[model samples]
Target: MHTEIQSMHLRASQKQLTLHTGVYYTGMDDEAHTFCTVSDSLQHSPSAIWAYLTPVLDRIKAEVSDVDTINFYSDGPATQYRQKGNFYLFNKEMADRNMKQATWNFHETSHGIGVPDGVGGSLKRTENMSVLHGKDITTATDFVKTVKTPDSKIRIFQVTEEDVKSKIIEKLKLQPIPGTMKIHQILSVKRGELWYRDLSYNSMEVHEHQGQHLKFFSFWKVIMLYSICSLH
Candidate 1:
């Protein structure tokens, strides 16, 4: 999911809200589900991303109880999903949620256009049509209430600023993992392990790493290492 600024032409307020849209694809069911989280908070930090994603993940698990693995495809923005903070969350949260394994695959820069973008565009167009029909979507809450109906195709949820703040508090202490920018796939198969490589198919790089490298470092441990690296 990516953050998009969706402007609403309300008769009074006319504010812009952040729309985090994601399209979920299930191969077993052969169906796609589109979900969005509307928030007034413009920050696209790791906390905010997780805040937007939590409800969607919960819904997925609720609907598909047999799902043990998840695969995510998104653009690689360091400030968002491509950095160390997110990796920590990805490793910790999957285990917390009883998920067996997960993989995050990042599209190369400037080539991320796909179904998620279409979902966002479709939402913008829907909101635009609503505005044309004399509906006012002045705030993020209003956007969610106005857009999501019983028969709506896209399930919309609201993420308050407090939710993001709480997530920030929950994942407060984090250490930046080295070589995050060069990584394209992060795969977590065990509780405290994350396997990553520059390209998903680059088995040679994985082989050079001496097989199954990149063990998960706890926050305090990584912080100590970070301090050591800073001194040198």
Candidate 2:
């Protein structure tokens, strides 16, 4: 399971608006859902992305109550899904939801094609066709009404500026791990443990999350041990 966000443009008359769209899917499931938020600006920062994801994740949790572990596959975008802010927020949500484990796997640069990509394309295509047929989509609400059909599986949400501001998690602060790129192949963060691996999925480093931050010394020790083993 993973998430992807894309910015789409809509027009009515001479006015143009930006729609921040998110698609969540797991390959095992036959159905995928789409969430859209209308914004006047095109900013897609970590907080903004998380704000859009909050409701979508809630809906997912409700639908998949039996699933203990939720894994996310996202592109390697440091500012969006891979940063510390997003990680901290996600960790807290995982605990609140009672999820046993949560893993985030970032795809290699320029190689992140998957189910979400198809969903995003389909959404834009549908919207484009509707606009061509003279559908009025000047606002986010209008866009939601225009695209939502009785039989449609895509669940749409219109997030406002206030919604984004209210969802910020100010208490959690994440520190970076030394000698590691922000974009890693696999990042598994359980209740108190964090593990990361390279794109090859070999050679992993684990750390303990202490209170609001991760214990950086634990990671440093792992690196030193690995270095010593290589020398031997």
Candidate 3:
């Protein structure tokens, strides 16, 4: 079906003769849009889960800032949990090891519950504004209507990695892939729909570290940055 839609009203500055187009899609993007087959950007995160959620820890530090002991794999209480001061960070790296599609996957600190038993929920919407890739958000917005997939009921993009990869390259105007990954925070969760697979991103950041220790440090870096940005 083809039809000519009415032109959108635009806002512009009159500093010069040429008028500026309104800032393209914003309100629509604030709504949830799927990025096809979702994947954790930190699939290869260091074996240490605490190391991964360091960003959220950093974010919540100001509000819950009273901790002398930060340990991964809690002792006496929980074994599969890690802590930064009093806050905790879950470990879900290997469980979802296809981070190539991830640009940001750091939104789990505030999103997680107490543990294996306490892992009641994972927020899929709390995002960091500064570090996120506006491109990813724009891509999501620009194609929200087109993101429908064969199975759109669950709200998936149906767009494959190849589809996004091409757009990314074109949109970013890159000469090469640069072979790097960015971090993001997750906001919502589907609860009980396969743990690791249920995780998503909220914010984003880029990394250029060696893979061996990348996940470990990246995990913490976001936690730290999370604290800084949350305050702003």
Best by lDDT: 1
Q: What is the TM-score of each candidate against the true structure?
A: 0.80, 0.68, 0.19
Best by TM-score: 1
lDDT of 3 by residue, 6-114 (tens): 3321325211111001011122244322122222221211122223333334433443344322212222212222112111112232113212222223333345433
Candidate 2 vs candidate 3: the lDDT winner is 2
Give stretches of model 2 more than 4 Å off: 1-41, 169-174, 180-193, 200-232
Q: In model 3, which regions exceed 4 Å deviation? A: 1-42, 47-51, 74-232
Q: Per-residue error at 205 for model 1, in Å?
A: 11
Q: How close is candidate 3 to the true structure, as a TM-score?
A: 0.19
Error of 1 at 91 (Å): 1.3
Per-model C-alpha lDDT, please? 0.77, 0.60, 0.25
Colliding pairs, model 2? 2-73
Tell me the lDDT of model 2 at 52: 73
What TM-score would you give candidate 2 relative to the actual structure? 0.68
lDDT of 1 at 8: 31
Of 2 and 3, the candidate ranking higher by TM-score: 2
